[model samples]
Target: MTKTNVIRQLEKAGIPFRTAEYEVDEADLSGVHVARQLGQPCEQVFKTLVLRGPKLGPFVCCIPVAEEVDLKKAAEAAGEKKAEMLPLKELLPTTGYIRGGCSPVGMKKKYPIWLDETAELYGEIAVSAGVRGMQVILAPQDLIRFTGAKVADLTIV
Candidate 1:
């Protein structure tokens, strides 16, 4: 189910995307390893983080896994005082996707997605493809449109 209709969102939105598959070892699912495996810089690989905000409902924020999320900053971006990284157990059901497979797109509900401004520095960015061992590469701006995400300073600045 991860690959089936998950990618349809990209097509329906007319978003240009490319697929990269790799062997996902039983290791920590982080941006560093993903970038290494994909043969791309860590900054080019975006990690989809699911956080629960008190005021903004559930929101999906994407940032370089190489960089840590500024919880308070994320909260402010979501118009809240703070945000917390939800537990994997809580996140799976809340997002209707697994941790390593969680994508900012194709969610159970439409969330206000936010991308760290730094990600826009690159012409291409990589994100999880609704499954582990898979990534989809596309323009950062296209991702903003596909997910209707707001591009903002969502970093720990």
Candidate 2:
């Protein structure tokens, strides 16, 4: 149970959260897999994605693990004409997080965050704890307040 930067940030913010740790399966880094490992529903586990727009630079979208981001909707949310996923090679340098472990919180900079509206359906949701095989479970409203995230329809229907 290592205290990752995400955990430390939440503590500093006085946000209450619980951490869950599980074995890391490099071959199955999907959020759905993580949720199953934690005995939770896929809709309650989110995956953080970083996307770049020509005008907006970078922004983050937190969507349910089982859904795919709708690039057109994401662009509209970010006020851009189009958006593209950030390349894997640039993730660490840009956000200080790697794939399968990128959390919406504790990035190098506070890029604008858009959380899928579906999150409101749950009282608590799980997101990466800034490391692989770990997740932070917290109230969705608390997370929204802490990150100043805008809630929207971010996933493909």
Candidate 3:
């Protein structure tokens, strides 16, 4: 298996992780589908989202595949008045990652990252390996430490 930048970064940091590769369906890039393909619960798979605030510019949030980010909470977490999803056109330029393959670990720039509090509920969680059809599984705390991510209730109930 080819090692994505994410995997290489983790290895360089001495953080242990495992990768899962599955067939990718262009039409169904949802994390839910990825979870099903890996035989893992939906909650164990996280989707990376990039959002921007007028003042903060850009930030990231990782939430369960089936849940939605609470923009209000996200804004509050970022110390902004409001936050909105980063338009698709700007994703690649802003994060050096395209849709369906944005991994919080290896963005072009180190933007603030927030991992939904629910991530702590599991011993391991899967996140994009910086490419389609691949996922990196590791302990949530390790990810938090590696990425300097803040944990919070960024998801809607």
Candidate 4:
């Protein structure tokens, strides 16, 4: 498997993860499309989102590819008054990851991450591998432990 920063970090942490590579279309990069490309159900694929909250400067969130992050719920989970998506222009600088390649693991800094509670339904889930065209699949619980993520109802049903 081609090792990316995320994979290397998982390896170092003794986290067992499997990788999958797919053709990427930079112009049409979306989590839903990624799931389709990987031949996986949208629910089994999670997308990493970075948000800026009124109280917290920046935070991370993960939700199913097909679900949208519930801002109110996310704010409650983050213990903030409100949370908004970090601007695209600021994403790269703030998280050290481009919009389409952001992963909850191995970010420039460990921003607090809130994972959707639905993740627990699956034994394993796929997330971006700090790069486009690559994905990593691992146990949701292991992902939570590695990222110190809080499980909450952060997505709209």
Candidate 5:
């Protein structure tokens, strides 16, 4: 696969990472499916989710593919009274990324990012490479350094 902005950015920053490519199934663009395709445990694959807080506008939350983001907990961590997922139609315009391909890194603009605490359990986790059908695997600490993500309880059981 041709390189995407996310890959280029990681390279430019000298962040060590490896790419994994898989077949695209437009109908099932779920992180769990991507993990299955990559032959990895679902918990190691995190999906980037964009949410709009009524008081704070847009922010990002990265959670495990097998789990869901707890909007209440996310809002609390973000210091907002409430937070809701951004409408699908606005994702591309807001972050320059499509629904299934959004990565916490290399967005059109920088927004506060939160990674589920579970990410620390692994040495490296997989996230989209700013495009569908590909993922970038890197150390969780490296990803945190690059995105300024706060490790928190962002996922639901």
Candidate 6:
């Protein structure tokens, strides 16, 4: 059993999931190497984004590679006047992730995490393993249960 904080939480909550590990240089975050190494389509590889409302408030969103999160739509989802991806400088301190490796689980705070509905289209999705060099494949429903995320129409196009 892996000894990550996320793993501990999953086990404590009794969420069923499988862990996948791969070797990849950490030079790129969105360069698509992990998906290829994992033998999964890019569409099945999900990414975690930490966004803040235009008003400088906190928000979190996760979307599959198959779609993009409309910032305006995301703002509405967060009940804010507007939304935008926070600056990398801000994300590093606020979300505690280095721009690309942020996962919806085990964040610094329990901010609102909205998962795009399209993610549900896949019975299972690969998400961050709460650390670099790893990923977790699990039922989408299980992720929802563990992350306390609400399923929402998070994409605009």
Question: All candidates' lDDT scores?
Answer: 0.84, 0.96, 0.96, 0.92, 0.95, 0.77
lDDT of 1 by residue, 43-89 (tens): 88989998888877788889987888888888888898878988788
lDDT of 5 by residue, 1-157 (tens): 6799999999999999999998889999988899999998998999999999988899999999999999999999999999999999999999999989999999999999999999999999999999999999999999999999999999776
Cα distance off (Å), candidate 2, residue 16: 0.8
lDDT per residue for candidate 3 within 1-157, as digits (tens), equals 9888999999999999999998999999899999999999999999999999999899999999999999999999999999999999999999999899999999999999999999999999999999999999999999999999999999888
Which 10-residue window of candidate 3 scores lowest in summed lDDT?
22-31
TM-score, per-candidate, Cα-based: 0.93, 0.99, 0.98, 0.97, 0.98, 0.87
Can you tell me which runs of candidate 4 are displaced by over 4 Å?
none
Decoy 4 TM-score against native:
0.97
Question: Could you tell which candidate, 3 or 4, scores higher by lDDT?
Answer: 3
Q: Give me the runs in candidate 5 sitting further than 4 Å from their true place.
A: none
Q: What is the C-alpha RMSD of each candidate to the true structure, in Å?
A: 1.7, 0.6, 0.6, 0.9, 0.7, 2.1
Clashing pairs in 5: none
**How far is 137's C-alpha from truth in model 3 (Å)?**
0.1
lDDT of 4 by residue, 36-130 (tens): 99999999999999998987889989999999999999988999999899999998898888988899998988799999988999999999999
**Lowest-scoring 10 consecutive residues by lDDT in candidate 5?**
148-157
Give the Å error, residue 127, model 6. Answer: 0.9
Off by over 4 Å in 3: none
Of candidates 5 and 1, the better by TM-score: 5
Better of 2 and 4 by lDDT: 2
Better of 2 and 6 by TM-score: 2
